[model samples]
Target: MLIRNPDISMSKANTVPFGIWPRLRRETCLDSGSSLGYASLVRNDCEKQRQIPVQLSKLSEKTTLLALVLGATLICGLPLLLLFKTGLTGNGGLDLGPLMEAVQSRSVRSALWHSVESSFLSALAATALGTLLALLIGLTDIRAKGLLVFLILLPMMIPPHVTAIAWIQALGPGSPVLRWLGLAPELGSTHPLYSREGLVLLLTLQHSPLVFLLVRAALRSFPRELSDAARVSGSGSLLMLRRITLPLLAPSLLAGFALAFVAALGNFGINALIGIPARYTTLPVLVWRRLASFGPDVLPNVAVISVILAVVALAAILLQGVLQRHLRTSLIGLPQDPLAIALGGKRPLVEATLWLFVAFVLLLPTASLLATSLVRTYGLPLSAETLTLENFTEVLWRQSVTLRAFANSTLVAGVAALVIAVISLFLAYFLAHRKPAHRTWASLALTQSEVAFAVPGLVMSIAFILAFIRPLPLLNISLYGTLWIILIAYVSVFLAVGLKPVAAAFLQMDGSLEDAARVAGAGFYRRMTRIFTPLAAPAAASGAILVFLTAYNEVTVSALLWSTGNETIGTTIFNYEDGGYTTLAAAMSVVVVAATILIMLTMNALARRVPAGTIPWKD
Candidate 1:
């Protein structure tokens, strides 16, 4: 019943108390004492008030997105930039002279060639073995498939240094198993596993599970109808494998191969432990040796080597991207149950063979590790008389270095995990819910993290050294030789690990709960705490655990970063092995392996509460 106020002005009415109040007041003259002057003043105030929040919110969003980009750049981007600057420039101008010199050096060339050769051979071996296992377990009617897969993956979960230590003990001349079986090499003869061939074998064993996981996942989504149709068209088992299964698996195989290649190229433990003894230096080993021997005087040279390593890793990443794009298939609906081929009378033999392989790969080395840990000295044969807990007690109780390493690793790894988990949660939230423009920036920031993670740990460590070797600009304090530098490096290298599961969880989330909280007048923090955090906690925790596991016993990043007081478990063990304390190293490695298994088991216990794919060991 309100008359149109053509004279009173529409703008004044629309500004103050929204349209309803204006119309009501104008129609009824509800406030007899309120004049048009007062109304206009109130309207103006209200208009200003209303615009503030909208402006502030827009500002806030822009600020947050900007901060995320800057933070990611600081953490992940700056180091690589610094590395390149150090490697590619000298004096006051751009120069690739040092890099060229490094590339031309005989030692550098040999190390580069060795890295390429070992990585390629190891990746090929891993791909072949992994594909075979994946087909056997994923497509065939294999017994105890879950248990077998878990056991096979145990090697991958074990730290590379630990694996190297165990294998060293297992195959060395003094091996308890080898000696017991009368197959031990003579004490004066060289260990069989201290060569380039040995490096390839260990790299394959450590990384084969990666290929297996990728191929197994692909096998799970495979269209069973193709196999059925092949059989119906008179294809035998072997023919079906050749014509239908293997062809479809090519992309995954290639992807896995690339991943293994990258992993092997970056390997520090096997390269240092086995390669050094056999005079088979790889690029990572060269970087370590240079840094260890010459300190910062050889920084430019090592930076050049780091760049080469990073380039190789980046190439692998690009290849993986290309393969993924090309491999995209147009499949119908949800994937059906995996095809299970029967083995008939060959089932028993196949199962036996698989179990035997598991025993040889997992059980034997682990047993050797345990035996070596109990011995009084490196070459001492294990017996009732020779066996003692002295090695364990010495490392676990007597040695301050070992205790400090454990404490430092736990503290640093724990903090890194927590910090990364929190940062990743916010980042993932922005990525999942932000506007298109903001998301692009956020994605660009995420790529920085990817670069940090993808580059070899040794290279990343060098990057950090280059970036942080100097004192802070204003604070005038150096982080050059502290645990903080290692912590920062851990955060950079493992940020991607923490982000993956959280981001996956967010992408799959309904968003309705968050939307409802917003509609209910909940603030950003309120909604995040009450609605999003609880939902994403499991995935975040899983990521945190992974970060902790990767960082706790990590040698590669800390290898070059650790100072006298700040030793990591990995570096400590490596030091022990380097210093002829093999028995002590074995003891620590045993504890680490035990701790890793315990953590995985804890995650397994909580699998029901976590998201389906959160725990990798679970079904």
Candidate 2:
């Protein structure tokens, strides 16, 4: 209610809104340059006042981010740290004695040798077969190419243990097909699949699809001009393939081989099922057997073997990286049409051979599983008289353990998927839109997740055991023998799978919409909730589905983590098989396969809405 002085301006004399005084003063000071010092003082005070909210916002964001980073570090980083800690250090401090003893042990040496030899052999076979199929289907005018490719990829989607089981049932002494044809091996005879050769064969069949997918992708991007130029120079098909195609495809072939080799090296299911019986243990199987038999006492020794396995896997990854560096091809523009090779008279023969391969690889094994599931007993042939639905009924309804396992796996996988999806969205946002400093940290966190996934599941399980066997500090709680341990392991292992699609989606997204939102004074949360979430939802959903599919049937990580009362689908199937309940295991596997296919089909229906390349099975 005080009167203003006459010298004061009318604008300065009027009462201002609560937040408008700073702006009015700022404008007046700007208009009159003589008041610059006053302007500086006012501006600084206003900035300090403004910074409170901003600082609080930043503090909140940083707190949330810190929590996320610490969680990831606990899940992914701690296990690896524990592995090195156990392997390199002990109560005595910085000791190499355990590692040296493990390396020199006869069992360890034998397992390492078997792992290396079988992995190399299987990789070679898989690469050759996959490359051949890729060349034939991707380059030539093959009939039903899509269907053939899908069928070929099906084997890779099946769990390794399930593949082991199917092959065992298909070629074992009591094989239904072999018995039907009167070519079954004698009852007491050794099963044909219980050998190193059979192990390699099964591994080759399982991993060949990996090579096929890589080579086919490469072929799809192949320059049409090279083949066209070769043909114009009057080169024959074989010559052109040898010179132009193979040379260009060398990197993909090597990459495929490296991937297959790494996969075989870390394969626990095949090694456990087939190699154990064959007395040809691999490192993964050795680790499992040691831990299962001796408990935590053998953890230090097993950590050394895990390090060896990790070294081999890392070497393969490095080799693939080197190969990929040399794969660069100069392109004028988008890739032209693929070179189409007309088979003409040989088309029918080629198609028949492809179908035969499919029948052998996919149809036969699945048929064997179905037949085994329907049988009354393990060795009983599947006839109208012997066939029964009792195994299915037993596992699905009557057996409480199996029912519990089903429930456990579904609940765990679903929760993992949902949680990972939500976490991945925030991670991807940070990766795509954060400040450079924040992005660097985000990328480092992502690398940890990759390391978790890259390490074999068996090795990861060992790491988790070593890390969490004792009670956690401060909390005084032990996660060692709990279902929470398995859930934590799944999150660590599958984080990369969940992040990939979301990151890809973010990379392809337009930035202007976000910028416009920010310019309109929308906060980070608003922009994310209103713009980013909608755009990235499809990708996140796809990634979640992928995680579910992968975790639902996974056995390697849960093999050692499962306790007596808590069982997973993978563990249950394995236990059934281990306990000589083949029909029951087969019934469970059939249900799992059917569930996987149904989920994949549902995803296929939704694929159109999702970004391309999000679904592994889709084009």
Please give the clash total of every predicted structure, in order: 0, 0
Could you give candidate 2's per-residue lDDT for residues 83-103 as a string of tens digits? 988888879889888888888
State each model's CA lDDT, in order: 0.86, 0.85
Worst 10 residues of 2 by lDDT: 1-10
lDDT of 1 at 420: 91
By how many angstroms RMSD does model 2 differ from the true structure? 4.4
Candidate 1, which segments miss by more than 4 Å at Cα?
1-57, 223-236, 511-518, 609-611
List the lowest-lDDT window of 10 residues for candidate 1. Answer: 23-32
Model 2, global lDDT: 0.85
Candidate 1 lDDT by residue in tens digits, 1-619:
3434444555576344345755544433335465454464355555564466556656666787788889889879999999988888889889988888988999999999999999999999999999999989988897888788878887887889899989988998989878878888999899899888999999999999999988998888877778778888988889888877888888888889998998899989989999999999999999988886886568987898899889989998898888778876666646778888899999999999999999999888998999999988777778999989999999999999999999999999999999998888878888887478877888988999988988999999999888888998999999989999999999999999899889888898887877677555465566677888888887888788889988998898999899999999999999999999889999999999998888877877888886776686565
